[model samples]
Target: MAAVAGIWLYNKGAQHLVSLAAGALLAMALLRLLPEAQEGLVEQGLSHNSLFVFLLIGLVGFFLLEKLSLFRHNHHHEHDGHDHHHGFDKEEAGRGGWMILVGSGVHNFADGLLIAAAFLTDVRLGWLTAVSIGLHEIMHKLSDFSVLLNAGFTRVRALAYTLACGLMAVLGGVLGFYVLSGFESFVPYVLVVSASSFLYIAVADLIPQINAHKGLRAGLTQAAMLLCGVALVWLLSPAHQHSHSHEMEQHEREEPHALMWSRSVL
Candidate 1:
């Protein structure tokens, strides 16, 4: 659905869509993913600094890949038999489309593991987590499609690649469900890597492209779109699980009674 929508709207307001996506990706990393990574590390009794290190490693690795022309998204079509060339920056964009998919694949796989963890902990919690991830992924996938288009992928190729990358989540979920304890200690680090990928894409990749345009009007419009994107993810964040408050309170209340009952029985 997101791919089709993007293809249909590609002719109109594609740049703004990219800006919105960049903003959302930033929010997903900063507001959501990073915090979750920190909490997971703390839960697993791991040093908090490791999160930062993983993030740095992810960013630098992506930077190096782009430098090597392996992750370049700049596309220039040289026509032979089929002419579909919209010259952007052929050298810079080379192979970038595949790079984005690879990054997204890693992130989605982590998402599957996280969702599986939530389900193992509690079914209700798992459902809530799944819904949250679904909403965020819709926006994330849309932005990915926009970035691919900017990198010069045809509509067909972009959609196919995006869908293919999305399947990694399924694989992760299966692994997570069957082997939860084995992966439990490692989930936090995976999340950190995911956050790093999003930060690198939003900051190092997408921002430069959008920053080239000058003019107060364009600036203000971009700012608004960016905020809107952040707002979308922020609104959908796990922090808004107020509906679980009653359940949590009830659990707390039961703990003392359960303890007393156990003691009396003994």
Candidate 2:
């Protein structure tokens, strides 16, 4: 069970492509496709002001996270006892790496809740959220597992630790969905929070990893790659990716689970 969970989380990176596809599907569900399908009544649309509100909330939420030393906090603060260099370079990712395991567990728990909410919205939404989660989790596990390995855990032990952490999503998703469903009157608020969660993870968790490269040239290159990923996601959005989510599903299917040495794709 542990190994299966580890491998499942390890595959999250591969799901990024599919996330783009999911975005495309969502767009179709909103725009050209959805409009035509509606007999007469126009569906509700997202508001820019509301989006701004969500963005503000995400900023504040992450600020609290920063204060609490949660996810992405390590991108700035160094651990007192660990060597951050060559994280898991043929070794555990760092010393006293239990901190990472703990942090990751919390982060994954939040993600599980997000997944549950998405499912409660609808099956399509749930499936999309699951794939997004799967992508996020795989990269997460890869990173956490590497950290454990860097902290002197054997590969097998590291895998075990990561798998234990990975399975937390199931319970989280179910619980979150149930809890959030009771607040259906606050759909817009929920949407805002969900968007904020995505923004927080991308900006908070992933950006720092890109910024930490040693050289100026390397940093610029990484920055470019980051933009490319965003651009690719944008291109595949329903507005451009051919009005369907199949591309994302196909892309996810093609993504590699074992990237050999790292979880850089996340």
Candidate 3:
């Protein structure tokens, strides 16, 4: 569904969609994931520096991964005795595509865990968390589609791969339902690593591709699309969900537990 829509939208425009993806990834990493990870670190009495260290390691790890991808691609190209040129190399694009999938998978899995935890705590809270995640996933899927297309994936492959990545949430949900209490402490670290992946893709891959287009109108259009991407994440952020949860808790406090339980059950 969402994956199909993303493929359709990507066919409409590629470069603009890449710009938008870059923006969305940047915001999701910086504004949403990092802050959330930091807060969780505080709650766990962990040093804020530890998160940054993990973030650094994630970035370097991704860089090495890309280098390996590029090496293999170049070796294959050489073996074939063919030279190809493009604004962006196929190897780089492929690396970006894989990175997006990896990052999105981790992020979605974390979201599933959170949703499961919320449900375990209260059915109403779980529903709210699920709804919030659903909305966020739509944006993420759309952005991912754009990157996948730019990476030279066929529409069918992009849709299939994206769907496969999305399914990771189900795996996470099942695990979270059974082990959330034990796994709760690691969520923040997962988030930070995910953020690093997004950051690396956005900065190293998408931005460079975007810079290849030159013109005043193109620049303005790309900037606008990028800001729109950021705005989407800002509007659909987890902070709003947390605030809503707080309000629900406050309301439950005003009411009786039996009434709240009945409402939740209903």
Q: Which model scores highest in lDDT?
A: 3
The sequence of per-residue lDDT tens digits that candidate 1 reaches over residues 88-135 is: 565555465566778778867877887776666446445545554554
Clashing pairs in 1: 72-93, 72-96, 73-93, 74-93
RMSD of each: 8.5, 14.3, 9.7
The top-ranked prediction according to TM-score is 1
- lDDT ranking from best to worst? 3, 1, 2
Error of 1 at 236 (Å): 1.4
lDDT of 3: 0.69
> How big is the RMSD of model 1?
8.5
Worst 10 residues of 1 by lDDT: 73-82
Kindly list the per-residue Cα lDDT of model 3 for residues 1-266, writing each as its tens digit.
54555555544765777777778778777877777778888899988788888899989987886675531111211222223445758888788678777877876676677667655544643554454355345545766766677778887897889999888888888888888667777767666765776688678767876788899999999999889878877776667667888999998797897787899999
TM-score for all models, in order of appearance: 0.61, 0.57, 0.58
Best-first order by TM-score: 1, 3, 2
TM-score winner between 1 and 2, please give it: 1
Per-residue lDDT of 31 in model 1? 71
